[model samples]
Target: MNVKQEHLKETNPEHEILDILKNRWSPRAFSDKKITEKEVKILLEAGRWAPSAFNVQPWRIIWGIKGTETYDRLYNCLDEFNQSWADNAQVLMAGAFKKTKEGDKENFHALHDLGLFMANVYTQAHSMGIATHQMAGIDFKKAQKEFKIPEDFHVATGIALGYYGGDASVLPEDLQEKENKQKRERKPQSEFAFNGNFQNKN
Candidate 1:
């Protein structure tokens, strides 16, 4: 299940290197295929290498394998809406960012920097034949309390990573259609980016 970066390209790649930029997305269906700890470490190592402002690495990850006690606790904390889709994941992770680094004043781009690192995690997992779907619609306050997190750390998102699951009928009707399609669709690049001037288009 080695997903070549080229195979994931939305369009042709003279536009961009498939591995560098491609159809990275979130999906609710997970194959319940447990990834080895070594592979998980490899994914995080990719995150550790992400660039940061003044080299301030503000990201922190709390993870657990499916069926573990820790995983149970973390899983229980999610809203039921997420639980239905996420319980099938082979691996679940809680993300947070240390707002203040020692000898520093400002919070540093805690959330933003964490986001960059998470991108690395996502891409690395994708290249490894793992699919990751992130959930921000989670209980941040509860995660902070349960994980015994420091006051400066802000819970960011929960992630579900594993292989793709079987069918779309497992999902709610609306989502079933999207899952069945299995194609990348977006509003339009111009709607989100501009070449210096803001010419809004969708």
Candidate 2:
């Protein structure tokens, strides 16, 4: 599948936004093309600049490119559902965050900061013609143990990174339907963007 053909699924945003943002969507199908080390570093750099509470910068990523022992370890941390398709990705990553502040106090905002870090990585990858899928379907405890993560940190998500547009036929029948989806949908601003007090759109 050609990369250009994948753009047909770009979202129809109600308001103008960056083309990269509009075009970005998580795909279960990934091209096997390898991502260069330099490109990986660039994506990490983008995450490194994300703002954090008191600049604690709690986010951390343990990543490995395909065909490496590290990659296999990361892949094993994913749940069975993710492993079904994520094996085709060129790179895999474990996203983690430090749970404590300097005094061992809880950093309630750690997960939020990690999300910001990922948003930067996602935008950067999209600009580079790369596609990324972030998954919560991972064995966090397994990832923590496999990576020998310290007690202060916790694994939160797994990430698959690769080029867009792969052979959907390689996926299971149900997943192939998702891989070939032509439209992207999102909640309207009114549903979640309240002008003042919160209102339950549901």
Candidate 3:
């Protein structure tokens, strides 16, 4: 099932915000289709353009695609269950951040900047007709050691990206059941954001 971007594009993008937003949900289910290296390079390039503190560009993308050393190294770092669903993904991307540029500055602002990079990864991929999923369910410390990441680099998260498969074979049965759960139920904006100061109500 080659799920191209056109089949996934929900809205006409002609003043239809809901159409786009409504279709933008993370899917753990990914197809076995091969994503081109060109697309991978372009997506990472988008991430490279993310805003960083003092132009340090602290983000690094360590990736494993199908049959490479990276595949084994990253798979071994996952926490069992994640390796189940994520293993089927076309690409396993590790988002790493540099603690400091030139090994100086008490506050390197890597975490803050890495966040901006991840945003670019998902949104840009979406616009390009690609689907991506960011995963936090991995042993970060183990990944750092396995990937030969330097002392200055911190493994922030793992991301599984590619086309999404539509069957339960691509995901665990329990997770598939939750696939269509409403976004509002996941996190209401009121709980995550406030009007001004600390307000108890949403």
Candidate 4:
């Protein structure tokens, strides 16, 4: 049971947006095809140009291709649920951030900056016809220990990358349903975007 990227693409939007932004989505299913090192480097280059507070550019990434020791170690850091589906990913990455500035002062915006970096990476990957799924279920401490990450850095999230379209039947039944879902939903702008002062839509 092969799935096509078009089958999962979001066809409608409340307002017009770029095709890439409109079409990009995170999918649990990934193809067995391998992504080349050059392509990975290009994705990182996109992230490298993302804006950061005070130009701190605090984002750091530890990535590995499948079948490597580093990939196995990174996979071990994922929670059982993520490991179940992410095992099919051709590439895995741990996204981290520097928690402190040069003088040891806390960089309060580090996490936000990291998000920006990942946004760049995600959009770039989409443009290149690659699919990406970001996962929050990971053992941060385990990743730090396994990668020998510095004390000043914090592991934030994990990422799975591969070519778009895959065998959705390989996923667990529940996730298979999700992978096959065609409609992409999100909160309307009215719920989050403010007119004047901030208003809690919740």
lDDT of each: 0.77, 0.90, 0.73, 0.90
Tens digits of per-residue lDDT, candidate 4, 73-97, equal: 9999999999989999989999999
Better model by TM-score, 1 or 2? 2
Candidate 4 matches the true fold with a TM-score of 0.95
Could you tell me which 10 consecutive residues in candidate 2 have the lowest summed lDDT? 1-10
Q: 102 in model 3: Cα distance from truth in Å?
A: 5.3
TM-score for every candidate vs. truth? 0.85, 0.96, 0.82, 0.95
Query: Which residue pairs in candidate 1 collide?
Result: none
- Candidate 3 wrongly placed segments (more than 4 Å): 1-22, 180-186, 200-202
> 90 in model 4: Cα distance from truth in Å?
0.7
lDDT of 2 by residue, 61-100 (tens): 9999999999999999999999899999999999999999
> How much does each candidate deviate from the true structure in C-alpha RMSD?
3.0, 1.9, 3.9, 2.5
How well is each residue in 9-122 modelled by candidate 1, as lDDT tens digits? 244333555653466656776665678889889999999999887788988899888889878878977888888767778888998988887676777577888889989998
CA lDDT, candidate 2, residue 99: 99
The CA root-mean-square deviation of candidate 3, after full C-alpha superposition on the true structure, stands at 3.9
